[model samples]
Target chain A: MKVLVIGAAGMVGRKLTAALLAAGQVGGQPIESLMLADIVAPETPAASLPIDTIATDLSEPGSAASLLQARPDLIFHLAAIVSGEAEADFEKGYRINLDGTRHLFEAIRLSAQLYRPRVVFTSSIAVFGEPLPAVIGDSQDHTPLTSYGTQKAICELLLADYSRRGFLDGVGIRLPTIAVRPGKPNKAASGFFSGIIREPLAGMEAILPVDDSVRHWFASPRAAVGFLLHAAQMDTAPLGQRRNLTMPGLSVTVAEQIAALRRVAGPAATQLIRRQPDEVIAKIVAGWPQAFDAQRASALGFRAETSFDEIIRIHIEDELPPVQP
Target chain B: MKVLVIGAAGMVGRKLTAALLAAGQVGGQPIESLMLADIVAPETPAASLPIDTIATDLSEPGSAASLLQARPDLIFHLAAIVSGEAEADFEKGYRINLDGTRHLFEAIRLSAQLYRPRVVFTSSIAVFGEPLPAVIGDSQDHTPLTSYGTQKAICELLLADYSRRGFLDGVGIRLPTIAVRPGKPNKAASGFFSGIIREPLAGMEAILPVDDSVRHWFASPRAAVGFLLHAAQMDTAPLGQRRNLTMPGLSVTVAEQIAALRRVAGPAATQLIRRQPDEVIAKIVAGWPQAFDAQRASALGFRAETSFDEIIRIHIEDELPPVQP
Candidate 1:
């Protein structure tokens, strides 16, 4: 089997490529060739998996057609500008996230001259916004808060329609916040959810923007990977009109995250946290959904970490501990 | 009130312009200038009102900026390709409906002038497709069955987000089938619904594709204009996160239409109907949602025809000979 990862250089993209190599196949099919593409040339996996990596923009005219020329059987679409950049620069967001996804789908349709492939697209929980009940149900209409969310919601609509029309099998996974992400805190509003734990674990102080009781949704990186693999292989017949699935997530609060941090790294780590009120960040965070009732994905056999503690443990496993002097 | 009517040459556009003129104002403000734009130059009553017509392609680069330059205080965006044309030529559909709408909203945001306008856009029931309950509730997700529906759903999302940000105040009205449409049937699959009755009334035999029991939604042309004008003037404060709304409609099938025709004009109109099954058209009709729960739209003060009988009466009043004739 041949596999192509469309966003091979990004965080989850790199991990997925590694997981594919570690498994030696996709969906029990023996891997023959792995083709990877990203906006920038994907890092040659530090002498790990034998892979061919190329750099290209998917939204460029005919670029998707050129990318799909090799006709890999499994395609993972994970490329997108983050929320802040999307809201700030609408043109870039629509061009990359919306037009790019459409181009990819059209490429598959244009390529039906030869073959069809299974496409697993990474959507986000951001497709949902407020006026959402305390617990958002599975079949709720997509009311996005940000431009990025709108783009993702639009892409999901295209994916379902394209798949239903038989261009290719498509599964869109609305991933949860990847907790304990192994990196310095980024600009995402949800960054602090990981920042408090990550910074404290590293003996660095971090600021909490909202109240400790403010709840939000999440999933471990391990589970996000599982969602992609499962969606790529599952029988899409049951999906019928709904091709997009909200991946299972843990609805935890800042208080819960800090408590878990203190348990793992002691009270000293907890003491590194400071309360600083930033209403701008708080208001942005307020628009973000706290919980998701992802019954559909769960019923379809998708899995995730049951608790934030497990998510922290997964982070520790993925990224080795700091070496002592 | 300065009014901008996009797609001013289209059927609904022409009627909406007339209704706006009849009212002489919107939201209780005196009418000032009217901006009319379309690919085809529109017919404006410049002799009576301050009307400017521009033949502009909305999807072209900077076209939206050019349109927004007029700085109309309120806008009615009622442009879209019919479903069959949209499905047949997918790229054109996305270009005009999806990208065009985005460009318009973006232009509104970039207006360095502090002039924000109330944009009223026309959506369609095509946004909801198969596996539908007998009555599709207002809260259902837009599981569009066609590319046209997807494009409309995307535009609706953009409208909501833009409204949320206050870049523009907008309302998306999901119109029902405009029964007794005063024109020839175009490529839309539902065009047949109007075609059968219109042809029969014209003493011509009309083809019916689906079962008489097939139920679908409807509103008269008069009601549609009401929706547009209401959307322009309604208090949008109550619609916190929901900017898109499904308009009120009457649910009737072919059998009921024929019955209504018989009652209105005796059996002469009903007997002109022909039963010819077209598999392709039947399949297309099957996937569309049959009815709607338009509570939100009703609460906001939009109303539709009461029944198929009343709809037939409307056609007679608007399309048939006057009482003297």
Candidate 2:
């Protein structure tokens, strides 16, 4: 199977590409070739299979269509301006998040005569806003407070519409916040969710921007990549009319995160976390969903870590070296 | 207040226009001028104030901007291809329903410097699809099964986003199926909902396409106009981030409708209805929402007929002349 990964340079995209390469196949088809694209050229991985990398803005009129010249059997669209940036730059956010997704979908639709590729789109939990249910179910309405969330919700609608019209076979997965995100601190309001764990594990101080009582949903980076693969191969007929599903995630409060950190890295490491609440971040995080039923995803065989401790272990094994005695 | 009605020639648009003229005000501001637009020039109604009529497609590149030349303070966007036509013509549906709405919104956003208009958008209950709850609430997620519904859902998202960004003050009202419709039966699968009552009341036979047990939500043309007028004047602060709302409507089964018809128009009038099963239409109607909680719209003072009999009476009072014995 020939696969194309848009936003291939990003964290999840890179992880997904690596997983795809390691598996050597997608949906039981041997990988013949792989194409990676982003706003910046993605690094071509060392693999026996043919791999091509391109730097292009999919929102550009013909940029997305040009990528379809090869007509890969599977496409993973993970491209998006993160919440903070999208909320700050309205035009850029809509341009990249909303218009870019549409451009790619439109390109696939226009090329449907040749092939109908299985397209997996990455949506976000941000699609849910304030006035959330105590436990949000897959059936809850999307009332995004931020522009980025709005963009994601709109794209989910488009994905369903395009798929229903038979322009493409599409599946949209709303990913939970990836705990212990292996990177420098970012500007996302929820950045602290990962920052506190990642920094403390690295023997560095991390700021706790909100009260430990603030709870939210999460999954490991590995689970996210798994969702992409499963979505690519799943029998979407069972999904019926609703093409979007909220992926299974571990729901935990920040205090539980600290307790998990203490169990994993000792009290010394946990002490590296400092509480200095930032009201702006606190206000933003307050509106986020704390938990979801995610019954549909679980029933579909999609699984995630049941506890924050397992999440921490996964992060340590995946990103950290053995701790010194 | 100056007002612009984009679909001024349609049923709801004409009634709303007439209401505005009769009241001579919206939100307590006297009407200075009114602009009406449609694919065909809307007949300029005689009024004490200026009424400009123009035939134009809002989807055209500059067409929407041209309508904004006058920069009316209150804008009513009700232009759309009916459900049946939209379902039949895929490209036309997206072009008109999706692109047309975006053009108008973009036009408003671009012209934000001139003034922030109160935009009253006419959405529909079609935004809800199957797998619905027994009573869909304001928070029900949009999972439209039809292209027309998908377009409306997407537009609702855009409206909320635009309103959040302070580009325009928008209020989207999802109207119920209007009953006792004052027109010939069209191709909408739901057309028979009105046709059965309208045709029979006019002393003509009407076909019942589905079982009498088939239930759905509804409001009268007069009540629909009432929703528009109320939505235009209402304070949106209570709505917070969710700008779109499912307007309160009566939920009734077809059997109840027949009973109500008998109460208002006599048992002889009810006998004018004949049964004819249409599997295609039955399947279509089967997917529609039978009821809604609509608590938010009700709390905000947007009212509808409490019973189906009142709805029939409304049609008689507004559209039909005095019934002769």
Candidate 3:
């Protein structure tokens, strides 16, 4: 089986690529070749198998077709502009997020009639907006409050339609906010959710923008990758016409996150979180879903950390250096 | 206020235009001018107010910008190819339904910074698909099974996002299947819902493709226009981030429809109906929404007929020649 990973330079993308390389095979079929695409060519990782890294901007009209020429059997599309950037620059956001995804789907449809590959698209929980129930159900309407969310929702609809039309076998997984995201903070409005945890864990001061009572959903990077793999290998027959699924995640308040961080790294790490209420970030976070009844995805075997303590532990194990005696 | 009607040639568009002309005002504001646009130029209606009919394909670049040159205060975007056509011709469907609508919205966004038009977009209940509740709520997740439904659902997302961003004041009303639809039967799979009553009323036989137990939601063309007009004039303040609404409609089974036809025009009219189960259409209709909990729309003051008898009377009153005693 051949594999393709778009946006393979991002944090999650890099992690996913490394995991795929380690696995050697997906659903028991050995991966023959791998193609990694991003806005900038990804760093070549140590792998025994044949791998190709290409710098490509998917927003460009012919870019998707160029990537499709390899006809990888399984494609993981994780490309997207963050929420803040998307909201700030409307044209750029739509061009990259909406138009780019459409181009990819259209290219797949126009490819040889017999070429139907499994497409695993990463959607976001941003698809849900304000006036949300405390626990959003799998059947909640998509009333996106931001351009980024809107673009994701549109792509999900297109994925279902294209799949129903026999253009491709597609599954859209709406991932929860990735907690303890590795690396430096970015422009996503949800960045602080990770920043407070990641920065503190790295023994650096981090801004706590929202109130301790502010709650949101989360999943570890490993869990997210697990979701991607499950989606790629799962029986799409159960998905039927509704190809999108909201992955299960832990729901935690800011205070609960702090408690978990303290439990894992002591009060010293918790002290690094400075309570500086940023109204803008607070407002954005307020509209986000606190939890979800991801019954469908859960029923289909997707899993996540049951507690924030487990989440923090997973982060430490995955990203932190081992403590010496 | 100056007004623009995008699909001025269609049945609902024509009726909406006629209603606007007859009223000579909207929301108590005297009509200054009217611009009608379609793929084919609509026939000019006699009116003292200035009106322009332009033939243009909105899918073509710059076409939308040309239409926005007038900067009409109110815009009625009632344009879209019917379901069967959109299902058959995927490219044409996306071009006209999705890209065209986006072009129009983008044009509005790019128009004068201060010139925000009241955009009343006609969406369809087809946005909902199966595994559906017997009575779908306004919050039902959009899992459209068809290309046309997918396009509509995507447009609805775009509409909400644009409205939230303050680019335009938009309202998307998801219209129920228009029953007792005017003129000749078209290829829409839902055409029989009207045909059973329409063709029979005109002394012609009509095909009933599904069982009498089959149930669906509906509204008259006149009611649809009312919904459009109401959507145009209603205070959008209450809508906030969620600008799209599922308009209220009467839900009745085919048996009730036949019974209503019998009550209205006796057994003679009911006998004109022929039962010829069309597997293709039956399957398509089967996936459609049977009813809706359009409480939000109703609370917002949009109204529809309560009974099929009333719906049949509406068709007789609006489309048929006056009865000569």
Candidate 4:
């Protein structure tokens, strides 16, 4: 099996690439070659297998086609502009998020003579909007409020159609908010879900924008990578016509997240959190979905951390250095 | 109010154009001018107001842009390839159904320096797929099973996003199967919904490809035109972020339709129906939605016939020449 990872320079994309290289195989087939693509050329990690890194924009005409010259058997489409950036720049958002994804799918169609690659696409929970029910179910419709979410939802629909038409084998997984996201805080309104946990663990103060009563769904970065790998190897027969799915995740309030953080890193780490209110962020977050009954994905063997504590532990084990005496 | 109809040659488009011309105003604004566009030039109907008919394909580059040059106050984007045709020709489907819609939207955005036209787009019930509940609701997710359905669903999402961003005042109405269609029968899988009634009423035998037990949702050609007109004038403030709506439609089985036909046109007219099952069409219609709880559209003043008898009467009153003794 050969593999291609789009957006390989991003955090999840890099982690997924490393994991794939370490495993050296997918669905019991040894990976013979790998292609890592992003807007910026990714750093080449030392791997026994053949690997190529390319800096390219999928939205540009023929760019996607060039990347698929090898026609890698397993393709992970993880590239996207985050929600904040997408909202701020509408043209760029649609260009990269919507047109770019379509370009890639069309490229796959052009490439597929007999070889149909397994395409694992990363969708987002933002595909849903409010006037939402207490808990969103698998059957809930997509009414995306943001440009980014709408783009993801459109891609999911396109993927299903392309898959049904036998152009490619597609699986779309709508990821939960990733708690304890590594690196610096970004512009995402939901960034606080990770900031409070990540900043505190790193001995830095983080602002809590909303009230403790505010609840949300979450999974860790490690679990997200796991989802990609599983989707790549899973039997698509069960998916039928509806190929997109909301992934299972831990549902917790701000207070509960704090409690879990206290348990994981002691009271000292918890105290680093500060209370502040921003109506703009709160209003935006209010429209977001808090929990979902992702029964379809769960029934298909996709799993994530059941509790925020496990999520924190995974982040510490994978991202943080060992504690010094 | 200046208006432009993108698919002015189609049945609903023609009806909608006639309704608009008759009223001479929309939302209390006097009709100023009208531009009618389609793949073929629509016959110039007798109207007091200024009207122009042009032969154009929206999928062709610059066609949508040319229509927008007038910057009409209201735009009816009703162009699309029907289901059977879309499934048969994949590229044509995407080009006309998806890309053409996007081009119109992008043109709207470009034209929105000061003028933002009210865009009333026609969507369809095919957006819902099987593994469906007994009754679908307005909040039901779009899980399109066919290429045409998928294209419509994607357009709905785009319309919402564009509306939210203030690029255009857009409303997408997902019309149910239009029953009692006038003129010749088309190749749509759901064509039987109309053919079974239209052909029989015209003294022609219509094929019944499925059993009478199969139930489906419907609205009349007049009602569909009404929905479009209402959407054009309604205060979009109530719609908020969700601009697309499932129009209220009558839910009835084939047996009920036949009974209604008997009541309206007598046994002689009903007897014109022939039973000849085509496995292909039956399979396609089987996956379609049976009924919907379109509470939103109803509350918003969009109305449809309650009984199939009323529907049959509507066909007689609207389409047929007076009963000749």
Candidate 5:
């Protein structure tokens, strides 16, 4: 199967690329070739198959069409401006997140009469907002609080419509907030969720923006990649007209996350988390979902780490160097 | 208040225009001027105030900007292609329903730094689709089965986000199917819902394409106009970031409709209804919401007819000549 990975330079994109390369096959079909695309050209990774990387801005009218020229059998669309950036710059957010995704879908629709590639899009839990039930069900309304979330929700609607029309085989997975994100902290309001875990594990002090009582949904990067792969190969017949699925995730409070870190790395790591509160981030996080009854995704064979301890362990095993005896 | 009514030529638009002129004021504000626009110029209404009609297509670049040049104090955005046409033509649907609406919102946002207008947008119950409960709640997930519903759902998201951003004071009302629609029957799949009542009242045969047991939500043209005016003038503080609402409507089965017709206009009017099930329309209607718990709209003072008999009577009062006893 020929595969195309958009936004292949970002952290999750890079990890997904690595996982795809390692798997060598999807749905039992051997990976014949690969194409990686992003605004900045993705780094060339070691692969036995023919691999190509290109820098392309999807917001540009013809860019999506150009990307579809090769007509890869499977397309993983992970490109998006982060939530913070999207909310900060409204036009840029809609231009890239909304228009860019539409361009991609349109390009696919007009690609050819018979070409129906499997398209897996990564949505976000930001699609749900406040006044939410403790355990949000799969059928919860999209009351996105931010422009970024609105863009995602709109795209999810488009994905479903396009899939129903048979223009492409599409599956949109609304990923939970990825915790223990491997890298330096970013400007995303939800960044602290990862920073508090990753920084401490790396023996550095991290600021706790919200109180211990603040709770949010989470999944590790490893689990996210697994979701993308499963979405690509899954039987879409059962999905029918509803192409999007809210991914399964662990629900944990900030206190639970800290407790898990303490259990995994002892008192030193837990002590590294400082109790400096940031109201802006806290208010933003307040609108987010604490948990979800993502029954649809779970029933479709997608799974995530069940506990904060497992999430912490995954972060350590994946990102940190092994401890010497 | 200077008012701009886009799509002022449609049935509901004409009714709203008439109502606006009769009131001569909105929210205790005296009439200043009126501007009506549509793809084809809306017919000039006999109003005492200064009223201008213009031909415009909102999807075209700069059209929305031109419309907002005067910066109307209140805007009624009631333009859209019907569901059947939108379902038939994908590109046209997105262009008019989605991009057109976005263009309008963007125009308002970019009009001036401090200028914000009350934008009353007419959404539709089509935003909700099947796998539905007997009575869908205000927080139902948007699972639009048709391209039309998808477009409406996307616009609702945009409306809320833009409103939250303070670009515009927007309110989206998800109108139930407008029953007893006047004039010749159009090609809309839901047209028969109105045709059965309208044709029978006019002493003509009307086809009932779905089974009598098939239920759906409905409101009258007058009620829809009321909802729009209320949405434009009501205190939006209670809405907060959740700016869109499913307007209240009576839910009734086709059997109830016929029964109401018999009660209102005798068995003669009911006998004009012919039962000829069209599987195509039946399948389409089956995917629609049968009822809704529109608590938010109800609490906000938007009301609709409580019974199908009342609905039929409304059609007779609004469209037919007065009967002398």
Candidate 6:
């Protein structure tokens, strides 16, 4: 199977690509070749794994067509402007996240005579925002607070329509916050989720933005990869007309996360935490859905980390420096 | 009141314009000027009614910005590719409906640096389809069956977000099938709603694709005009964050419509109807929402014709020829 991974160089994109390569085969078919794309030139492994990397900005006109010329059998569209940037630069957000996705879908649709690609789009829990209840159901309305969420929701709509029309077989997975992400905190509002765990493990202080009682949905990075792989191979028939699914996730409060942190790293890890009451961040976080039933997704074989402790351990093994920072 | 009517050549657009002119004002402000636009140049009344007609295809880049240059106080967007055409030419649908609406919304958002325009967009019941209950309630999930419905749903999402952001005072009214539309039978699948009455009154045979037991939602041209005018003037404070509303409509079966036609135009109107089942068309009609509990719209003072008989009478008074063939 010829596979294409868009946004191949990003963190999750990198892991998903590695998993795809490691599996080496899907549906009893060994991967013949892989085409990877990113705005920055992606670095392919030196070994002859039959991978080609291309650097191009998807927002540019004709970029999607150029990418579609390769005719990838399986396309994973993971490219998007991140949340903070999307909210800050309004035009760029709509241009890249919304318009760029549309162009890519259009390109593949217009070229179906030669290639019919099955696409996997990475949507986010961002698609669900403020006015959230304690537990979100599968059919909760998408009331996205951020521009990024709005854009993602729009893309999900597009993906479903495109799939319905038989232009493509597509699946959109609304990923939960990947806890124990095993990296320095990025600009995401929920970065603190990782910061508290990652920094504390490295014997550094990490500030908690909200109270310990604050809760949100999470999944380990490994579980997220599992979701991507499963979505790539699963039978989409039972998904019926709608192709978007909220992936199974673990719900945890800050106190539970800290307890898990202490369990994995001992008393020293708990000592590295600082509480900073940031009302603005707290208010923003408050609106996010705390948990999801994910009943449909789990029934369809999607799974997540069982506990925050398990997630933290996975992060240490995968991301911690061999030598202390 | 200065108002701009996009898709001014459409049936609803013409009726809305006439209503505005007849009202002589909006929100207690006198009608000063109207700017009309469409792909085909509109032939608005030439008797110095203070109207400016511009023929422009909004799908063209920069068209929206150019149109907004007029800086009208109110904007009524009633433009879209028909559902069947949209389903057939997916790209064309997105280009005209989704992208076109986005460009116009963006134009209005940017134009607000100097002037904030009040926008009334004509959404359709097509936004909801398939897996619907016998009577769809307000706030039901949108599961559109066609590409056109998807585009409309996507646009509705944008409308809500933009309104929340205070870009424009946006109001999206989801209209029901308009009965006795004044025109030749168009390609719309729901054209049967108008067809049964139109062709019969014109001394021609009209085919009904579904059984007379099939029911659907509808409003008259006059009621549609009322919806536009009300949406233009009503207090939107109660709408809060949600700007899209399902307008009130009369739910009636084909048999009921036939009864109303008989009452108004005698048995000849009923006799002209021919039953010829086409599975293709019947299948399409089955998925649409048959009843809507439009409480929000009703509370907001938007109403439809109470009876299909009144709807038929209005069609006769305004559309039918004085001398029958």
Residue B117 miss distance in model 1 (angstroms)? 2.6
Q: Lowest lDDT 10-mer window, candidate 6 chain A?
A: A41-50
Cα TM-score per model: 0.91, 0.98, 0.98, 0.98, 0.98, 0.93
User: TM-score for model 5?
Assistant: 0.98
Report how far residue B211 has shifted in candidate 3, in Å: 1.2
What is every candidate's C-alpha DockQ against the true complex, given to 2 decimals?
Answer: 0.69, 0.90, 0.93, 0.93, 0.94, 0.51
Q: Candidate 1's residue-wise lDDT over A287-314, tens digit each?
A: 8778878898889999998888888878
Docking class of 5: high
- Would you list the clashing residue pairs of candidate 6? none
Per-residue error at A284 for model 2, in Å?
0.7
The list of candidate 5 runs beyond 4 A from truth reads none
lDDT of 6 by residue, A286-318 (tens): 888899999889999999988888898888788
Clashes of each: 0, 0, 0, 1, 0, 0
Better of 2 and 3 by DockQ: 3
Instruction: Give fnat of each prediction, in order.
Output: 0.87, 0.92, 1.00, 0.95, 0.97, 0.37
Kindly report the root-mean-square deviation of model 3 from the true structure over all alpha carbons. Answer: 1.3
Winner of 1 and 2 under TM-score: 2
State how far residue B22 of model 3 sits from its true place (Å). 0.4
Across A1-325, the per-residue lDDT of candidate 2 in tens digits comes to 8899999999999999999999999889898999999999999999989999999998899999999999988999999989889988988999999999999998998875858888999999999998988799888999999899999999999999889988888999999999879989987778889999999888899999899999999999999999999999999999997899999999999999999999988999999999998999888788999999999999997999998999999999999887699
Q: Worst ten-residue run, lDDT, model 6 chain B?
A: B40-49
Q: Which stretches of candidate 2 lie over 4 Å from their true place?
A: A322-325, B323-325
Model 1 over residues B1-325: C-alpha lDDT tens digits? 7899998898889888888888888989988989889988999663467889999888999999998877889999998887877888878998999888888998999896587799999999889877778898888888888888988998999898888778899999999989888776666678878877788887888888888878889998888998999999999999887899999999988898889888877797888888888889888888877888889988889999888888777777777678783
* Candidate 6 C-alpha lDDT tens digits along B1-325: 7889998898888888887878779989987898889989887765446988999988888999999876888899998888888988877998899989998988888875657678899999998877777887665767787888898889888987788777888899999998988888877888898999988888888988889998999999989989998988888888877788999999999999999989888998789999999898898888888999999899989989999999988898888667666
lDDT (tens digit, per residue) of candidate 3 on A1-325: 9999999999899999999999999999999999999999999999999999999999997999999998999999999988878988999999999889999999999989899999999999989998999999989999888899999999999999999999999999999999889889876778888888899889899988889999999999999999999999999999988899999999999899999989888999999999998899888788899999899999999999999999888888999899897
Candidate 1 local Cα displacement, residue A303, angstroms = 1.0
